[model samples]
Target: MKICVFGNSHTACLIEAWRAVRLGGEMDFFVQAGTGPAGMQLADGRIEPESARHRAFLERLGLPVRLDLTHYDALAVVGCGISKFRLTDVLNCCHVLGWPCPNPSDLPVITEPCLRAALSDALAGTTGASLVRRLRAARADVPVFAIPQPAPSERLLKMRCTGGGFRRLIRQGLALHAAEVFRQVARAVCSAEGAVFLPQPDATMTHGILTTGSFSTAATRLVDLKTPHPDQDILHANGAYGAVVLEALQAALRQGGKPCIPR
Candidate 1:
């Protein structure tokens, strides 16, 4: 089936996998750099990229700036700031009911309901969320899959991005709890707007919220796949991880086998 995938640099990993093991039908990828989903819109039910200052990126990659959505059977959005990592700020320094994080900081205790609302609000303002809104407004009749950014690499445990807050969550046996909560909120937000939220595949995760080191090692950049991601970089995953996600997406889209994105 034909599919269109849109996102920021994270689309690179999927591109790399697509090149290595091409899908049978067709898939087009449109990538805008960085985390923000600026310069684009669902104009007249078409994927328009005119205002995007980085349309050059798409042009350079030979991807289309303007697309007719009717040509595709499905749409996939990858990594435009819809991520569990967004919850790190709260998971690191705050305490919510049922977490039992001892001295989680001198901060005020927050109930789970409050945390859900906070997560929902935070995700609603993201680029991914905005795109979903546009799709809903346009009433685009197609299967929409929204994929979040891959978890940080386990190797980055000592890095500031994967700071003591996350470490505490892990040590306190709350890693899965935090990850599941984020997933539920994200899924709910996307579903409310007629989209499917696909969290990171299980095969690529460690410690619940962290990516397996194998998926981060030698990961390539989106625009220039030949160029390797910095050794210390942990934010992105490799083509292997991308391939796994694609398989999951295909399963869910086909509704034929064990789908990764649950009902």
Candidate 2:
């Protein structure tokens, strides 16, 4: 299968996973990395790689900006508007534990509707959804899949991105519960936009929110290859996580056959 994935840094881990599964021959992947929504756009009725760096990366991958999508078997749109750490202090401080619990010992709760509303508000103008819309407009018949960026690993509390206050509450298993709510909301967002949303594989998750230790290390792609261990990379998942995603994608493709996108 020839698959083209358009994403940000998270694409690195996915590629690593592809290699880990030894799907090199069975699946050929072309990937383009972009900063955010700035990477892709629809111009003059044609899909184009917007960022110069992204375009160059595609070229390095032997996929040019004007490359034909029809030649590929499937398109996997990853990590565009998706936030790798949804509950990070900067993003969801207001709704971190589903409610503002000043104390970690205080259990916070959120209703489904409330959680969905929050997610919708957070992901209102996601680049992934817009990209999918443009792709579907150009090729409605093509199978397109949108996978959100992986959730933060359990080491999230140690990462500088996480606030000390939120970190304490997350350990109480609030992060896992919040992740389930976020996943549901994310699916609803994808469904509303006519894109097939694939959640992170269950096996890669240890406590639902936290990533498993085997796949917990951040992708070396983000750092110099010489760095033996990442001192602060609680975001990206290792190849093991990617393997699970690939397996899940294959299963999903098989389940839907050729008609994968929900209209």
Task: Tell me, by TM-score, which candidate is best.
Answer: 1
lDDT of 2: 0.62
Lowest lDDT 10-residue stretch of candidate 1: 254-263
Off by over 4 Å in 2: 20-34, 41-47, 61-65, 87-92, 95-112, 158-169, 222-229, 257-263
**Clash count of each predicted structure:** 0, 0
Name model 1 segments beyond 4 Å from true.
51-53, 160-162, 256-263
lDDT of 2 by residue, 104-151 (tens): 343345555655676676664677777666666656565777888777
TM-score of 2: 0.78
- TM-score for each prediction? 0.91, 0.78
Per residue, candidate 1 scores C-alpha lDDT tens digits across 1-263 of 88888888787888888888986778988778787455576667787774645677677777777887778877888889888767877655567866666762577778899888888888887888777666555545677888998877888677764456566677788889889998999989888767888888888999987889988788888766678888888778889988988888887778832212322
* Residue pairs with backbone atoms closer than 3 Å in model 2 (clashes): none
